[model samples]
Target: MSASMDIRTKSLSKPVNVAQYLFTRLYQIGIRSVHGLPGDYNLVALDYLPECNLKWVGSVNELNASYAADGYARVKGISALITTFGVGELSAINGIAGAYSEMVPVVHIVGCPSTISQRNGMLLHHTLGNGDFNVFADMSASVSCAVAKLNDPAEVAAQIDHTLRECYIKSRPVYIMLPSDVVEDQVEGARLDTEIDLSIVENEPEREDYVVDLILKTLHSSKKAVVLADACAIRHRAVPELTAFLDKTNLPVFVTPMGKSAVDETKENYGGVYAGDASHPDVKALVEGADVVLAVGGLKSDFNTAGFSYKTSQLNTIDLHSDHCVVRYSEYPGVKMGGVLRKVTERLDMSKLSVQKIAHVGPQAVAEKLEGADQIIDQKWFWPRVSDFLKENDIVVTETGTANFGIWDTKFPKGVTGLNQVLWGSIGWAVGACQGAALGAKDAGSDRRTILFEGDGSFQLTAQEVSTMMRHDLNIILFVLCNDGYTIERFIHGEEAEYNDVVEWKYKELVTVFGGSEQRTKKYRVNNKGELDALLNDQDFNDRKGMRFVEVVMDRMDAPNSLRLTAEASAKNNARRE
Candidate 1:
């Protein structure tokens, strides 16, 4: 036998190409689809996707692909995106940074030149004429929890597994550099037998028990206690524990803006959205007046906390976090929130807890307060009605403009998942994220509907993503709120500035222009409440199996109340102080 054949016969398992090994790892981790656009460097590797039964989602651009990947990861636990070296990876950086800031787990893979070319210092097309291949990898490391430059065949499998494990456990994006030549390099397939360790980091048992005891003692003595859940609760995958605590205590539960839909809003003990001064009057009174506050996975970003407007005292707050626990003045490091929450719930004494009485003050009660039912669609009436239109388990993706703030007054049905980039506040994220989230919902094997509400200005940034959704035949409903320009920007600095204005496109005609057939794509234009109501009430429109687009016209100056308040505070903070 030949030397190679003789060695192959004695191998513990058959050899697999680098692409096969990578795809198999992804598949084993529940990734049914791979998201990215094809570039020359990655084209050969793309051929190996179907070998492992992974569908390729070819997004319109690298930036949109990254955004879509973020959305997919938020829904499906983890997702992967691929791009060519410099140009492609740089375009996706903004989205990756957003994922890092918001703690979404996405795998960003960049395909680069062969080892020979890189070693020879060959100037690549995507390069900055510097003959440097390591620059992009270095830049990505800042935004990723871990990065793997897959160059050695001997260690490729281990590198991929370790990087993926970081992405999973940290719940943040990871970067992988896959060389074009490495795409076909042979690796030991036997390494796939050991699954990546994705278990949550454990806390020191003695410290954990002490923290739980302190929390219990504080809660038992408090005359009033409130639970405030935020984005990290969901990002760290601790919703079960958070919900259990809420259900057991029956304490008034509230959410920060970034933590929308973290808890079951349909529950009786639920209060309403709390974003400091931007909060509802009733919600503000309830949350600020608490004696002891239990904050779970709290992320107090500027806008999320209404420009640092929180009145809650840390002296009376017990902040539960992913890596540490804070009780009033004491801090317990390495004590992750998951274990602490689980322990707290397990040891919770129901009788010692001061249960809060329920009073209705959430999104559902806003309709009766809305006085006018004018034909013109106003922001006040539009959002509350959207709350009613939403169904359970629907994936709702909102833009960072008015849609993000407008959704504050909108209470979600049970099991609804909200996708938005509030901290990074990137524009044009929703369209791409909607495509990814819809695919994620489909991958989850649920009958969930994916819906998007984006300002015309924001949607125009990445409208091509909708075409990708059409290509996949995914069910999605896109609602474009046409109000002339960037509504959020208008409230911040430029109400009448020309910079915020955008060239309005015929939005309803986009589906057809994107090659949507009449049978698969539908469009509607509603300028008034009556027109919107008729379409919303139609059973046929509601049960459609394909893409649906609605252009709802509104006033240019009108903004959501939350947006106005947040913008006002932001504008004041921006100017030079006396």
Candidate 2:
């Protein structure tokens, strides 16, 4: 080995294309798959990506791919999706909007026509006959920070780096447009060292001291105070911090539906998921009767608040939201939720507050209810048995509609939880999320099994994803909640007689239909609790011999009670408002 001619020197001597280098940088920043439907303009990126160790996921439509990427990013930290100039990009707006609404970090990479062609007024494939790129650029402003580019090879590295950092810091989506001419050009400039920049800019919640001081003062005055935690709290990963705050204060805790996983459900003092009837009578009484109501990371939607019951003039309400914003309804002023909670938690009197006492009772009450339901819970029955088999570490994702309602009462062992209550209420989210969760678990090098409780209606929407899962042979468990109808919509307001019903398919046969080998799928049908019990007790079901699909037959007549009530209340409320 020559002393002067080292590995670094030799590696530096070799030249690489700028586009190729930029794609590599994306891989370094955790862009797994370039999700999109192939198009003429974007074909360059599709060609260049495989060399960078990226796989192009072929979606039936650009929108589905974007949504898949969004779900993947939401669970797996980060992901990117690509599409063609105008048509592909336009098609993906719905998924982008959903990501924007939920504050998910997804990068939208769009390929555009060359600058000369764009300026020459040439008709583009997906364009509305106008060469005006302003329309394309303007569409992204509401949901993302979008930048369209001319062929500047030098700015590739800088723009990529800037866009990622901006999106990460803001916890929002960002868009970057690549012109076809630019992507094919080779850079003649000196190469910069390719390293992963994972640093995130932390914005401390504004007005800290005032928020905490007000909360402490309010706590001292109120005899019965409650903390209403919502999805924002989970977004900030403030569960443990909020849990610590709850314990120190010994205040009652009630989570909105979106915040169901906010605290360990197995913990005592946790009023199991509250909103209308899901709010236990005791939890409801405390919430409705409280003098000072601290709503943390709350959603102001009618669904979360039970038709804005808390929109009161008399009660002193402190609202801390996920957006790092705060508001109050009080004779006295209050502070932002994050600032106050952070400050109060930092320096607090912990000597007197014994909140662990509530921990014992909180989970106990939930467990009691679960057990009571267990009397009617038959192992031969798919939902109850599957619910029972779920351990503390296993993660579960449920679809919207009937399956969502069915699993409302399913118990997660103290720490076991998953994502299902994303605000957009998008169906087919659970199946995609299950894939992401399984990937996350495998990446963590843990044996924590990832499972999905999918509704029959929603399962059909993303059925193609099964091919992706089977192709990868992911350690995932899929339990299809087979009710033979769109029971959720039927319960909500749809006509069960015609449109709500679906033609029954042998769901297990889908594995083979989707190209999974016989070894890749194990099929089971459970009509009653006995069949469910056998499957639940069988250890073979957990083995990764293949993807497991357990079809649990549910009575359409006995639809989920919570879902039925939710729809009814929402309808009645809308009627009243009208």
Candidate 3:
């Protein structure tokens, strides 16, 4: 039925309040828990959550709440973030921007003053004192893909549907301003019967066919065609199709840093990570030497590409993006990669190609330790050794510091999903993300263990979030690398600089302070490789139950080879006057 018809049938079905309608939409889209804090403006709206079958996840602060929502969205496809008018929304902006940059879908709902007060221009406590109610929404509009001012009862549900649709389809953040008065505004309940369609718009059949034919023809002519998958392929949910393409062609698959663990490293054909100059010698040679590069969902930012040092030409690379596809210099707008990949995989004639090659340089093959393992924890020993502890179907959250760069050295078991702010480079984000992602994994009904590798300096910024995890009794494994300061920043510019240092905190004690007891949560401080190995080998510790925290003390200056190369390149790039 049409929207007009639904409105007419309101008497047949009991009308739902605006908050009820909004919360129902969120619940419908698999947001089991809503993340954010409550305020005077949003307090009334919280009452309707239980009735809508949605759990409220009140965080330590809006910033952490936003970060949690981003993480939740990453695991659960989309998440909802609730905040109050000005201060609350502003605090959450950084996290929202991170989600926007990384293509995580999060609906940011800002509960504002009543519509009457806005028209009267009354100065509110959270306001700028200028009586501009629209200012916060305007500020968030820059980072959000869609903005909805939900005041009118007639348009509220439709506005929410449209905004949420954009959030899911575009895989980015969207803003919804829900006024206090509108919290109880009546809307036709019949609208809830029909679910909102969130299907991506299909590419023009003829154009898609042409693109697929072109890609296959190019592949047929090339002897060395390699699949270079990146962030967008995962973000746009094209992994299944991309996997099929890889399998059909039997081409070697290499992932970018953002696309780490995208392809199963356990696969025989899985090539090592390829990030410009930072790539492994064998992987680098194979990728750069390839006649054709099938670049899928690529977001080649400076850090991701080792300061944009990629030698692969656009002419040699066929970039398959979320919205479009580019073959050499030709751009096909509205031609999505999912359908194109699916078609290409179906029509691909692998028989025409010479020796459908597999990767000889697989990361699955662990080399014997060249250095002694008796020494204290260092980047080289730590990252590779930790890989043995990881299980398949785990959700690993790496902080945007040394942890992010170091994790590249660790090959994940199959189905291990990785979460790191590669493009945004936001520190202190992992703690909150780990919490939400744990909840997201639980909601997904997948028995995926959630593990967090956080740098001490980065963990300090959002330390309070651990309390939220304790309160929820989430099953999590946390690793804090205590290197005394900002290791990533130190390598980038300020090594030994006082400004780069952060005060050392007892990580194990913090978990206790956050309400975790020895009986309930396990906390360990491992200073060396032997201690780490013993802890990992403990059968009780590997149970994947309760909150387990480990603090790893390491040399402040030591970093992964990928980080060292990328940081030096980044430093040189920054220093360039040209």
Go through the candidates in order and give each one's C-alpha lDDT: 0.89, 0.65, 0.89
Clashing pairs in 3: none
Better by TM-score, candidate 3 or 2: 3
TM-score of each: 0.97, 0.84, 0.97
The TM-score, computed over Cα atoms with residue i paired to residue i, of candidate 2 is 0.84
- Name the candidate, 2 or 3, with the larger lDDT value: 3
State residue 179's C-alpha deviation in candidate 2, in Å.
Answer: 1.6
Q: Clashing residue pairs in candidate 1, if any?
A: none
- Segments of candidate 1 deviating more than 4 angstroms: 1-12, 365-374
RMSD of each: 2.1, 5.8, 2.6
Candidate 3 minimal-lDDT segment of 10 residues: 362-371
